[model samples]
Target: MLRLGNPGRRISVGLIGMTFVLSIFAGRLIQLQGLDSKVYTAKAAEQRVRPEKLPARRGAITDADGHELALTLEAREIFIDPSVVSAAKRDQVATALAAELGVQKEPIMAKLAAGGRYQQVAAAVDPTVAQRIMDRDFKGVGSKHRYRRDYPGGDLAGTLLGFVGSDGTGLSGLESTYNKLLAGRDGEQFVETGLEGQRIPMTGGTLKAPVDGGSVRLTVNRDIQWAAQKAIADQVKAVGARTGSAIVMDVQTGHLLAMANAPELDLKNWQKAPPEDWVNRSVTDVFEPGSTNKVITAAAALESGAVRPESVFSVRDNIRCADQVLRDSHPHPMERLTFSGVVATSSNVGTILAAQKVGDEKLYGMLQRFGFGVKPGSGLPGEEAGLLPDWRNWSGSQRCTVAYGQGVSVTALQTASVYQTIANGGTRVTPRIVAGTTNGEGVFTPSAPGARTRVIGERTAKEIAGMLEAAVSTDGTGNLAAIDGYRVAGKTGTAMRYDTRCQGYCGYTSTFVGFAPADKPRLVVLAVVQDPQKGHYGGEIAAPVFKKVMTFALKSKKIPPTGTRPPAVRIRAGE
Candidate 1:
C-alpha cells in the first residue's frame, strides 16, 4: 500500500522543489527591480553619461610690432575602440594606420588584440595627417582636435618668452608670470555614449563653452631684439665667455625694447636645454657693479652736498682703509683729480675718498633711492634686488669697498635703471616688459607705466650725465663704448666673479651700462659678459657689446643725432 502512494508523494516533493527555486528567482528579480532599483539605475546612468574635456585656446604672444613670438596651432590625437574593430579587419587597420602615422604596427596590433573600449594610437598629429586618416574612415578609429604651442621665431626670445609644458601650462618667463592671463578657462561637455564609448549624435546632455585666453603684447621690438641677441651672442663667443646678457630700455618710460641672452634655448625643444640657459640673466644674475657703480657713489656724494663735480681728491694707485688695501687695475702715482674726473676715470682710490665724505648712512640712502637693494619693478619673474647691506652692518673697509662697487651687488637691469634715472633727469621709472594685454574680443588694455621717484636733484643729474659722457671719451676706460655721431654716456664695470666652491672671488664679470645722445637720452642699454677667457676687462669685453647693441637700438628707433660733441674733461697729471 505504501509503495502505491510513493509515486504521487515523489511527484509532490519534486513540484515543491521546483516551486522553491522559482520563488527564489522571483524574489531576486523584485530585489533588483524595486528594492535596489536606484542603485542599479545609477550604475546604468554612469555607463551612458560621458564627460568630455574641451580645451581652451591659448593666447598669442606678440612683440611691440605685432610679430608673433609664441602662438598656438590646432592638432589632433587619434584613438581607437579596440572592441569595436573586427578581428579580420584588425590587422588591415593596424597596418594602414601604422604606415600613415609612422608608428609601429606591433603596438597597434597588440592594442587591438588586447581589446578595450578606448586606446590611444597617435598623439599630436598634424591636421593634414588627421584628415588623411579620416578620409580612410577606418572602423573604430577617430581623432579629436587639440592645441599645440608653436614658436615660429625658434629661440629668438626664448629666455624672455619662456616655454609651455606638455599640458599647455606656461612654465617660465613671461608665460609663467602672466599664466592666468594666458591660460584661459577650460570647458566641459556631457554626452550619452554608446557601448564602445562613441558619443551618440544628437544625444548631447550639457555643454559649457571654453573662454579663450587673453593675448599679451610686449614692449620688446623684434628687430632690435634680434640685433641685441646677435651682438651679445657674437661677443660671448668671441670672448669665450660662459654667458652674456643685454637689455635696452626707453630712458623716459622705462619700456624695455630688448632683453637678449646668449646661448638661448630653443622654444621647440626647451626640455633638453640646461636649467641655467632657461634663466633671464639680465634680471636674475647679480654681480658687483665695479666701475659702473662709481656713478652711484658720485651721485650720493653730490646729492649729500659732501662733494661737487669740481671737488678735488688726491687719488693714488692704492689706498688703505681699516685693515684692507684697495688698489686700481693699473699702477699710477698719487695725483689730484676733480670729483668728475675721478668718476669718469673710474678711479677706485678717489671714489673711496669721496664716499668717506658722504658717510655710510647717506651713501646707503642714495643707493636705495637709485633702485638698488630693491626690485626694479620690471614685473619679470625672478628679478633679484641684489645684495646691499645696511649702513649699520658695514665695517670701515666694507664701506669703502661698497663705494668702489665691491661689497655690493646688482643685476644688469638694475644697473640700467641707474643710468636711466640720470637720463630721465634723476627721476627713476619702473621698467616694464609687457606693453598690454588683449582680451578675446580684441580689446587691448595697455600696461600702466611705472611710478617716477626722484633720486637726485635736476642739477646733480646733469652734472653726473656730463661725467658719464666723459667716461665714454678718448681717455676714460669706457672709451670703447662710444658710438659714431652719437654722444654716449656710460660707465664700464669689471668685478671679480664670486666662486661658490672657494667662497671668494675667482673670475671676472665685465659689464657696461649707457644711454645714447647724452644731451637728450632716449635708449638705456646694459651689457654684461661673464667669465670671459679672452679679456676680463669691462672696457675690452663688455663695452663693445654695449656699443653695438646701443647703436642698433638708436638706429632702429630713428633717433636723430644730437650732433654736439661732449666737452673734453681734464684728469690732472701725476708727479
Candidate 2:
C-alpha cells in the first residue's frame, strides 16, 4: 500500500470527484423529468388509443306470414399475426390451424413466410369452428366478430329475394331495391390499448352505438310461392323449355303473391349460377302477347259497342286485311260463329274481323289501359317497359296482326295485369310485392296498397269474363285450364318468341293466364313457357300449370267456388 502525502488534500480531491459525478446524473434527471416529458407522454398515448369499427346488424326479410326468407348470422374472421409469431412456434401454429380449420398446411406456411402483421387465414368461419380454434390458444392467432347473410328458404324466392355481397351490401332483386332500408348506419368505437396492442382493463373510451337496420316484409305467400315455383319448374322441365315463369296476383289488391321463375339462383351459392338466373323473367322478358292479348281487343270492342257478345261473324280459314291475308290458327270451312264463339275457339280470322271494327287507335288505347306498352311499376330489378310502337308506326301487316294479338310485345306481368283487371271487375290495380317493414323498435309499418283505376265498364268486363269462361269450356281452346270445383276463366296463347340469340323469332312462347272461381275471382295466375321442345301449344304446355297453381291458390285462401254451372253460350250460328 502507498501512503498519502497529505491527508486533508487527498480528502478534498475525493469529495470534488464524487460531487462532479452526482451533478452529471442530476442534469440528466432534470432533462428527462421536464424537457422530454410531453413528447414521451404523447408517444405513449398514441400507443394506447385504438380505433375500431362496430358493425351494424343487417335486417331480416320475412314473408307475408312473418316467415324468414333472408337473415343474418354471427360469424368470425380468423387471422394470424405472422410477423409476431415466433419462428420456432410457426410450424406448430400452422399445423394446428390447418388441422383444426380444415385448411391445407402449405397455404398456412406460405402466409407465415409472407410475414404480415395481420394475415387473414379464414373468413366467415362458423362460430363453433372459430371457438374450437380459439380454444387452442395458439400464439399470434386471433379472430374478429363478423356477420354472414343466410337465405333460409334456399331458392324458395331466390331471384325475387336477391342476395347480399360479402361486404354486407345487397346485390340484386328486392335486396338491391331495399338496400338502404335494410342496411342501417354503422358505428365506431375508441378503446385504450397497451404498447403490445392489448386492450387496457377498466378504461372506458368513446363509443358510437350502431343503429340496426329495419326488417322488410313481403306480400309473397310462402306456400303459394313454393307451389308456383314447383309448378313452373315442372312444366319447364316437362316441356323441355328454355325457361318459364309463373305469377299469381291477388285480383282485388293486385298484390303479387307469387313470382316464380324456373332455374332461380341458388341464393347461398349464387355465384356458381349464370347471371341470367338472377333476373325475374316475369317482369324482365317481353314477347308478342299472342292470342292472350285478344281480350284487350274484345274489351275494346265491347267497351266501345263495336261488337256484342252475341254478334254474328262469317268465319273462314283466312281473311284479307291490308296487304296480308291473315288466317285462323287451324284451317276451317266457312262457318258462322257468334262473337263469343270466335273468342272461345281463338279464331284468328274472327279476331281480325272484330279488330277491323275496333281500329288501331281504340285497340292501342285498350292495350295501354290493360297495362301493356309500359312498365308495370312493380319495382322489380331489370323491369323492361316492353316494346310498343306508336299506333302510327303499325305496318300494313302489323295493322291486322295487332288486332288479333301479334306484331306487338308485352311482358308476362302486363298480360297478368290484363287478366287481373278482368278478374277484379274492370279495375286495374298496380302490382306490388313489398307488404310492409318493421323498425328496430319492433313497430310495424304497412306499405301503401297498390293504386286502382277503372279500365272498363263493369258490364263490358262481365261480358269478357263470360267469353273467357267459354274459352275454358269443353268446346274451347283452354279447356285444360278448367278446375273441377271452380268455374275457371282463362285464355291460351302461343306466340312467336323473339329470340335475342338469333335476333329474330324462333320458338314459341306458350302462355295461359286465368282466374278461378270466375264469378268472384280472388286470384289471377299466369304461367309462361318459352321455347319448348316437347310441346308448344299454350293449352298443352301452359294451361295445366295454370290449373295446378290456381287450385293451390284457391285452396290456400279457402275460397270455395260458387258451385253453379257455367252459363251456356252459343258457339255456332246454327244453335
Candidate 3:
C-alpha cells in the first residue's frame, strides 16, 4: 500500500469490500423484521403466559323413567411437541409412548423425528394412563379436555342412542338427528410459552367459556325397550331370519315407548358391525305389508260406510282382475263371510271386493289421511316416506293387490301408526321421540305436544278394532297372536318377497300390526321378519312374536286388564 504499485486495483478492492458489508446489513434487517417476527413474538408471549382450552360438555340422554341411557364424560387427547423433545432422548420417549399407547415403536419414532413442533400421538387415552403421562413432566407430551359419549346401558339402547364418531360427531339414530343440539361449542385461550417450550404460568389474553349443550329426555321406557329387544332378538334367532324389527308405541300420546331391532350392535363398536345391522329398519325399509295391510282396507270400508262388521260378502274361490287372479291362502268356493269374518279370515278376494266398493279415489284419499305414501313426520332421521302409487297410475289388479298389501310398500312405523289411529279412536296423532327439554335452571319443560287429527268417527274405530279383535280371537286367523289376559286386535301378513322369476312376488315378508287392551287400548305394536325360513307366515311367525312383545309391554306398563275373561277356547290347528 505504501508503494501504491497499482492505484486502480486498490480503489476497486475498497469499493467491493464496502458493498459486501452493506448487503450483509440489509439481509440481516430483512430477516429479523420480516421472516422471524412471528416466531420471536410467539416466544416472547410464551415466556410470560399459559393458556388453556375450555371444552363444552355434551348433554346426557335419559329414558322416560330418568334412567341415564347416554352421557358424556371427560376424556383426554395425548399430544407431543417434537421441538421440545430432546434429540438424545428421542428413542426413549418414542418407546415409552408406543408402549403406553399400544402402538409400534418405529411409528412413534418416525412421528417424533418428523420435525414438527406439535403432533397428536394418540387420543381418547385412559384417565390413568393420561395421568401417568402428565406426571412424567415431559415437555412434549400433554393432554386436552375432550368429551366421550358413554352408554352405561351398553347395547341396550345402542340402536336408538347411536354412536359418536372420532371427531365427536353423531352418525346415526338420535345422536345423528339431534347433533346440532348435542354438540356444544368449543372455546380456547391464548397463553405464553417459555424458552424451554413449556407453557408459562400466566394467561396473556381474554377468557371465553363454552356453552354446554342441552340434555335430551326421551319417551323410551328403558325397561320395556329391554324386554322388547330381548323378545324380538329371540324370535329373530329362532326363526332363522335375516333380520327383524319391532316398534312399540303409546297409542294415545303418540310416544314411541320402545324401538327394537335384532342382531343389535354396541354403539361404542358400531363401526365393527355389519352394514345391515346398522340400519334402523323400523322407519327406513318398506315392504309389502301382506295381509297386515288388510287392516287399512277394512278400515277404509268401515269408515266410508261401504261395509259393516256384520255385513257379509260372498268371497269367491278366485277373482280375476286384468292379468292377475287374486286368491285367498285357503281356497273358498263362494263362502258367506261376515265383514268381521273377512278380516278374521284374511281373505284376499273379500278384501279386494271391499276395496273396489270403497272405490280407488276414496281408498287413496283414506290412505293419505292414514299417513301412507307420505312421511309419518316422526322426526326420526332417514325415515322413508314409502311407496304409494297414484290413483291414476294404478292398474286394475294393482288396486286389488294393494288393498290386501301386495303392491303397496310400508315401514313398520307406518303400520303401527295405522293401528295407533284405531287405538286412538280413529284420530291420527304425530309420533315423538324426544320427551322434553331442560331449562336453564335445570327444570324440564315438556316439548310441544303432538297434534291429533280426526281420521274417522270414534264409532268407526271402535267397530274396526272390534272386528280386529275377532281376527286374533280363538277361532280367528291371528290366533297365535292372542295373549291370555289381554284382548289383542291384530292382523297377520305373509306376502311373498318380490322376485323377477316368479313373475312378480316370491319370498315373503311376515308381519303383524296390532293393539292390546281392546276395551281401553293402551299400546300398539308392529313386528316384521324380513325373510324367514320355509314356514314363513305372519300368523305363524310374526303373530307369536307380537304376542310375546305385547305381553311384556303390557306387564311392563302395568296396564290392567279391563274386561271379564272371554271363555277359553282352543286355538285351531290351521289357525
RMSD of each: 3.7, 2.8, 5.2
Instruction: Kindly indicate the candidate among 1 and 3 with the higher TM-score.
Output: 1
Give the per-residue lDDT of model 3 (tens digit) for 492-545: 889988755567765678888899888788999888987787479898888888
TM-score computed on alpha carbons, candidate 1: 0.90
Which whole-number lDDT from 0 to 100 does residue 406 have in model 3?
A: 76
Model 1 over residues 1-575: C-alpha lDDT tens digits? 45466888899999999999999999999999989999999898788987887888999999998999999899998888998899999999999899989988999999988887888887678899999988997879988888888999899989999998878899999889888888898888887888766668998654888889999999999999999999999999998998899999999899999999998878989989999899898899888888888888898888889898888888889988899988988899887998878988889999999998998898899889898899888889989999989989998789888997888989989998999999999999999899999997789999998888888989999999999898888878899999889899999999888968679888899999989899999999999998899979899899998998898888899999988867766665341
Candidate 3 similarity to native, TM-score: 0.88
Better of 2 and 3 by lDDT: 2
Regions more than 4 Å wrong, model 1: 1-42, 82-116, 121-123, 573-575
* Candidate with the greatest lDDT versus the true structure: 1
Hey, what RMSD does candidate 2 come out at?
2.8
By how many angstroms RMSD does model 3 differ from the true structure?
A: 5.2
TM-score preference between candidates 2 and 3, better one = 2
lDDT of 2 by residue, 1-575 (tens): 99759988988999999899989888888787788888888777776776777778889998899999999899998888786788898889999989878989989988988986678898778999999999988767888788888998789999999998878899998899889888887778787855444567788454888888889999999999999999999989988999999999999999999999998777989999898898888889888979998899899999889899999999999988777788888888998999999899999889888988988899888888887778998888888888778899999889888876788888888899999999888999999999999887778999898889999999988998999999999999999999987899999998888898999889999999999788888999999999999978899999999999999998998999897888889988879
Error of 1 at 208 (Å): 1.1
- Give candidate 2 regions above 4 Å deviation: 1-42, 98-106, 192-201, 204-206
lDDT of each model, Cα atoms only? Answer: 0.89, 0.89, 0.82
What lDDT is obtained when candidate 2 is compared to the true structure? 0.89
Q: Best TM-score goes to which candidate?
A: 2
Quote the positional error of residue 338 for candidate 3 in Å.
Answer: 0.8
